[model samples]
Structure formats: C-alpha cells, structure tokens
Target: MTPPVIETRALAIGHGRQPLGRDIAFSLAAGEVLCLLGPNGSGKTTFFRTLLGLLPVLAGEVRVCGEAVAGWSRAAFARQVGYVPQAHAGVFPFTVAEVVLMGRLARIGRFSAPSRQDRDIAADCLDMLGILPLHDRVYTAISGGERQLVLIARALAQQPALLVMDEPTASLDFGNQIRVLDHIGRLRGQGMAVLMSTHQPEHALRVADRIALFNAGQVIADGPPAAMITPARLASLYGVSESAVSASLSPLLSPERNVLP
Candidate 1:
C-alpha cells in the first residue's frame, strides 16, 4: 500500500521542551480528509505547528510525503504541503492576484519574476474558488470571508500533495462557512490529502472522511464520521450529556441532512 501523505508516530508536540500532547499517532492518505475535533487549549495549534515544522518535536516523528519533516527545506516543504491559517488580514500592499501568486515562489526560478504559467495557475485557483472577480482588489481591503477565500486560493495555487488548514471556518458567517466546506469536499476528489482542525462536529460530519476526537491534547477516538460523531461520542468529546447532544443536533442529524455514505 502507498504510504500516507502525512504521518505522526508516537509524537509529542509543544513549544521548546514543553510537551502538550503525546502518543499522537495518525496517518492521512491521499484523497482523504482527516478532521481533528477538539476544543481550545486542547493543543491543536501546538500539534499543527509540530507537523508543519514550525515547532520542534519533543519526541517521536512527523513525516510529510514519506520524508522526515525536519529534513525538508522551506521551499521543498512548501511544494509538498500547503498551509491556511485561521485568519488573515493581509497586512501587505499586494493585490489578490499578487497574494495568490506567492504560492508559486517555491516553484518559480530563483530571483526570477513570476512566469505567465504561474499567473495562469493563480488565476485558475481563484476561479476554482469563485473569487476571480476580486483579482484586482487589494487583499487587505476585502472582507474577512473574502480574505479567508483568498487564503484558500493561495494554498491551492501551491498544487500541494497535502493541505493543512487550521480552523478555516472559525470566523465566517453561515454562507461563507458552507462555501469553505464545499471547497474542502471537492479537494478529496482531486486526490489532495487534507488535515484540518475544526470545533464544529456538524462541519466535520459534512466533509471529513475520518474524524479524530481530540480532547486534552489526546485523540480519544478516531474513525469515520458516522461512527465517531454519534450522540454519545459528541457528549463525551464535549463534556455534555447524550440527550443534550441529540437535542442540539437533531436538525443536523435529521433524515434529509444525513452525511453518511
């Protein structure tokens, strides 16, 4: 069998010598969406930083594209893996197209300007995400939802084998959240592996091929959404009762909105 696009084995994640989570073993295969469901301070950010090579691993290993993450340089790593942070205010004077075009840096010839092909790829990514109309707009001037879409477009422009998104939908309104989730759903069909952290169980159910129940820096459970997102599981994950979970999710878990395949 082919190796997973991203794998963490017996890993410990935190900053410096601090270990927030341990025994963090998981693998994400091509054409799969793995959702990490957890609350704030559950060490989700620490875990992502470790996987992205931003923080050192206190123990064990993290591999990306079947190679050790610590050994890959920034340019090579950017080509194989892309990242979308939770929010972006763009803080730069670049336009939307310019921002997306930055994804091509790792692929572009050193010290050379972006090529026509690079621009084409960026434009295609924007079109794919339905944001082509905003190509000329200043990135920082756009609304929060538009900026979120822009960030996703930039990551897609990298043409990566794996995409790691940190709470991509945290600040979006209802409509925008659905848009982001729909785009994520489409990525698996394109054979791109995705690992994302989300607090919304309903969102995880809608888009994840597998859901890992994370709490107190540990993955308490891992499986398909149907099996992992039950009332009892939700209750356990969120420290609530099964009846309350069922009551809150009644509409989402209804006959018409069922996400099980």
Candidate 2:
C-alpha cells in the first residue's frame, strides 16, 4: 500500500521553550483536501510552521512520504511540498510571472537562470489560477484578491504533490473567495493533496474532504465536514452559544443552500 503524502505522529509545536500545541496526529493522502478550522491563537499557523520545519517540533514527529520530515533535505522537502502563505503586501515590485517563477527554484540548478520550460510552467500556473492576464503586472500593484490568486499560482508553479495553504481566502472579497475555493476543488480533482487552514467553516464544507477543528492549541475534532462542523462543536471551538451558532449557520447548513450566503 502507498504511504500517506504527509503524516504527523504525536506532533507537538511551540516557540522557544513555550509549547503552543501538542498531539497533532493526522495523515493526508493523495488528492484529499484536509482543512484546519480554528479560532485565532489556536496554534493553527504554528502547526503549519512546524510541519514545514520552520520551527522546532517540541515533541513527536512530522513525516512526509512515510519518512520523517527531519530526514528530508530542504530541496527535497520543497519539491514535495508547496506552501501558500496568506497573501501579504510585497515590498519589491517583481512581476507576477517572476514571483511565480520563484517556485521553480527548487527544481533548477544553483547558478542557472530560468529556462524556457520554467517560464512555461510559470505561465501555466498563472493561467491555471485564471490570472494569466496579470502575469506582467507588478506584484505590489495588484488588488488583494488578485495578489492571493498570484500567491496560489506561485505555489502551483512548484508542481509539488502536496499543497499547504494557510487561510487561502482570508481578506478576499466574496467572489474571489469562492474562486479560490473552486480552484482548490479543481486542484484536488487533478490529484494533488491539499492541507489548508481556514477560519470559515463554510469554506471547509465547500471543498474539504475532511475537517480538523482546532481549539486550546490542539485538534479537538476531525471528520467529514457534516459531522465535524455541527453547531455544538463550532460553539465550543469559538466560544459561542450553541443557539447562536445554529441560528447563524441555519441558512448555510440547510440542505438547499450549499453556497455560502
């Protein structure tokens, strides 16, 4: 049997000597979309950072392709995992194409310039994200929605087997948010495993195969969207009243309305 694309066993995460989270056990298979939903300060980003080897794992392990992540070299890790951080303003004015092409660095030689093939891949990624027309635009000049799409395109340019996105739709207009979710569905259909974090349970319902709810610095629940996103569970996760969660989500959770309001 094939091993999971990414897995964590008794994983713990933290900053310096302070532990932010622990017992993050999970596995993601190819073509699956696993979404992490949680309140702010619940260690979602810290878990991501630890998985990407940016911070030290306070305990336990992160594995990719059934091997410990610490055993993989940085280049090997980059080739296997593409990361899409929340979109932010760029200080430099690199063209969108140039920004996407940066993802190709892991595959290129140390001293080589981007070849025609690299350019083609970057263009394809841009086109895939429906922002091909923005290829030559200055990254710093695009709207936030456009910039988010550009960042996704950049991660896709890596052509990695797994994509880890942190709040891919945060701060976007409603239309752009839907667009990002639609593209995520498409990417999963094309057989890339996706692990993403989101503040919105509605977004998980739209695209995720499995949902993980984080609270108190750990995943409190993990299962199908329908099973994991109930009013009671969401109330506990976000410190809201169950009736409030039910009322606010009634329109969203109704069988007739699959689309977010």
Query: Against the unseen true structure, what C-alpha lDDT does each candidate score?
Result: 0.89, 0.89
User: Which tens-of-lDDT digit does each residue in 115-204 have in candidate 2?
Assistant: 999999999988877799998899999998898888898889898999999998986888778878998999899889999999888899
Tell me the lDDT of model 2 at 141: 95
Alpha-carbon error at 56 in model 2, in Å? Answer: 1.2
Candidates' TM-scores? 0.95, 0.95
Off by over 4 Å in 2: none
Runs in model 1 lying further than 4 Å from the true structure: 256-261
